[model samples]
Target chain A: MRHSGYQIWLLTLSLAAATLGAIVYATGMGHIAVPASEIIRVIAARVTSNPALLAGIDPVFPFVVFDVRLPRILTSTLVGGGLAMSGVIYQGILLNPLADPYTLGVSSGAAFGAALALLANLTMMGHFSVPLFAFGGAALTLLVVLYLSSFNGQISANTLILSGVIVGAILAAGISFLKYLADEQVAVIIFWLMGSFASRTWLDVTVVAMAVVFGLGLSFFYARDLNILSLGSRSADTLGVESGRVRWILLLGASLVTAVCVSVSGIIGFIGLIVPHLMRFLVGPDNRKLLPVSILAGALLLLVADTVTRAVLPVEVPIGVLTALIGGPFFCVIFRKRQRRVA
Target chain B: MSATSGFGLSGVSFDYGTTPALVDLDLCLPPGKFYGIVGPNGCGKTTFLDMLTGSKSPDRGSVTFMDRPVAEYRRRDLARLVALVPQDFGIDFAYTVQEVVLMGRHPYIGRFASPGAEDWRQVDAAMAAIGISHFKDRFVNELSGGEKQRVVVARALAQQTQFLLFDEATSSLDVQYTMQIFNVARNLVRGEGRTVIAVIHNLNLAAAYCDEIIFMQAGKVVACGPSDSVLESSMIKKVFGVESRVEVDDFSKTKQISFRYWS
Candidate 1:
């Protein structure tokens, strides 16, 4: 269970390299197949401000790589990383192996908001309206969960999760009601709820990138505290961690990351829950190592899934459905193996 | 009112909602001695330790260490001065013993910095002191109850605090492991000039090793003094509502108590 610093660094670097490789390889796969060399050359030409590298490639290839593929790929990658990072924080703070980014009902809140926006056909804010509403709903849900769980200024894990379940059930009902009201536009809401990465713009990538990067920094800064927190709040307090304050800060950070990612990507379910568990098995339970590894692994996993759907499959399936279909069975296997070991 | 060393509590009172856990308790504990807080169930022994460690702030009065209010110190600063080995220590993850022990150095290590050579040295010395260096790399969850408790004690030792508090830490251990932990605490006091206070349920074990004993009853201190003076038959009768015989051991010259019950 103990990995040396050298081993952790090597694993982290390897994962990072693999993620970069996956991004390039996935970008090249499409209806008009761009080669990996062409993808790399286009990216290098753009980054180095040297159009010379682009001279030999097809003129449409750079546009396809940058406008068509790169944005969707990067957005999915960042969203995956964000969700997985949030998952690590949530599990660490709540001290539950089953905890994920959506454990606090953030996804339910976001889905409800999106469904409402869709039913109302509110385009006042243009493309940003749905995501804005989704983010607002998610933030509000977290606040309610925190308020419900806190007693005498202390937030216990059990009560917090209980409140989340209670609130999430109510919001799920609300989302169904919105779907019922949609009637003719119901398919729009249903497709969105299923989630997809098609036609994702650069704006989505930028917003997700900011949130994920900031979240990574925040989670890493408190990674050691998160490790101590697994010892329970009392032990964490005795070790100089102001458990309540640190928990609040981390909860907010993780929730914000989750809210933004869900707003952009609809409801990608299992990346958050599964990636952290998988990375913990590899890097051990140290959050300092687990956080970085999970981020890279999540990005790689989701990018591969999205690529398989967008290019490998005869028809594109919604990214959310694909992840759940795959992740549900995978998670069950992990659970069964763990149960046997514990027994 | 302002003692320069050790812990000082004056008129300290705390309540969980309407039920008082500690009531109007005033006490001063000096340095470099092993003190035991002995009381029956529902008494305020654990709460008192909570106040001393600054984990709980007294609702009414004041709790101080080194002439300053404990509530005023930053958590990390206070952690450098006091460490507590709590009851019911359980880790949910598969953290290695060395990793768990090294967590005691959290206050000393920087936010962005990993444990340095000095931190590792202290951690190694602590594990070695508790004779757990052999399993330092073993997962803590895989260890037995006694082994886990030793690891916890090693963590506290790595903290290197002047004040060490144990809240019924040996309540779950076998007698041999209990003696092992108590021996470690005794060495910390007699050999290193550190203060060790433990809330002990086993009055016999408390009487055996503690330099002084404080008996609590109904959320108030009934008696506090040297072991021989405070651990008499009458004090036991008053605090525990039971009859007991107390005597000085022939070999160790320490007070020993035996309880009597209805046949």
Candidate 2:
């Protein structure tokens, strides 16, 4: 039976409210220790075009909220939402519950590209060069995977996945070799591979925002077709999905989403894999509902992870490790719970 | 054949890497009748069904429906006219029976549009017709093979198409499910003027239900006519290399075949 529209709307509204709350709550928890009220005041002062609200607040408040914390917070949140969105698309189009952005080796390809940039010292373009190379690597990997998997004008989902693993494995080796070439720069490459939100500026936020928003907009347009697709390609095609074309578009589209997310934040893990499954349990399997809700839930999850590591922990850990360390156990608990229910 | 009422394939052929799957095959399928195509394995029955449904195009000839080239219809447009029930009912997600059936209305619903009440009505009516209304709330994985097959049929029915194609849809089911699916199709053909073409492996099931049967061998049709006329022992022996006895079943008054020996 269909999920209640009223309930779905309420759930979505709650998530939206919670995500907004998460941003506010996380912004205040950093070392500078801006209170939640001051955090809101800083934002309110900026939006209302009144500098009076900033008076008597610690002079560091505006700088910390706007320059120090918010960008990192926003970037991580958007990247999380973006990764989850790509996860939803990949799982839906490939018709495999196991599929995610990394399932197709997109992250490996991006890391290899970023590694090459770091090794070669391609700093003339400055911060832009690494992400540019990363996008190139991801787009190229997608094309290669499609080429290797396609047969008689159709890309079999199994072949595509298998080919992704093969190509990803080779790229992983390439990244390792690049690490050796980097010598002293190996530290930077390793840090990048571990993934973080440190020192991210508004530029990174803008880049991820544009890509995720445009790609997700396109995905929502095809949301209904994606729903039909989980029934398998033949049924989807017979139901008027133009399954081949839709799959290709959504595959490349999801890859593009992954490309941007990796470019901004390096390879933050598990948000993609964990969010969709969790959201499916809550929202039912409808992509229309799942995609939007997963977007919010992913943002909240990643923001919390970023906050705990950046502030709550005594020593800063890579956000990627935090996600995996945190998300892995959560995923297992949920998976076990589901299995028991099934049994 | 009338200009606008039957499927016509003339001089059609297909090959899989130079191995011919179909060769210069010609067929005319009249609307409003239930037809079955049966043959030994590798006789291209599935391929023929594929071409009829526009899933595959012939290499050397054209297939037309209702006097229009099958290729000319847009995917969504053709979907309104033809729906296929694939043999595999495999789905990765654990959507409910209603969710699965509602997908049949995808062609009618626009992008960014959820299933409206009318679409839900069609889904409900289709499920009821297939006798699956009671299972509407159950997850599809919880269903029995026969119940799942009915859900599949309900999805096809919800497509609201003019032509229904079944590609070994009941191949994995037992005798009961086979008859159950066939009975559903039979009602569509008899009660409504809808056309159905099923590629079946069971000769007895084909003989019992199909109004007209086509017998194929080596990608070429060896017999095509009324079931009673074409399903005799001589054609069965010639095409299947099997000696068999064909007689009407007293219970259903339909042709029943009893196999003797393989040649």
Q: Tens digit of lDDT per residue, candidate 2, span A105-213?
A: 7777877887787678788887778777887788788778778987865556567768878998999889889988888878877777888998889999988898889
Query: What DockQ does predicted model 2 obtain?
Result: 0.72
lDDT of residue B257 for candidate 2? 93
Model-by-model DockQ, in order: 0.77, 0.72
Which ranges of candidate 2 are over 4 A from the true structure?
A1-4, A118-129, A143-166, A327-343, B1-4, B261-263
Among the numbered candidates, top TM-score falls to 1
- Overall local distance difference test of candidate 2: 0.84
Q: Which stretches of candidate 1 lie over 4 Å from their true place?
A: A1-3, A48-53, A114-136, A139-166, A333-343, B1-4
Give the B-chain TM-score of model 1. 0.95
Candidate 1 iRMSD, 1 decimal:
0.9
| Docking outcome class, model 1 | medium
What count of clashes does model 2 give?
A: 0
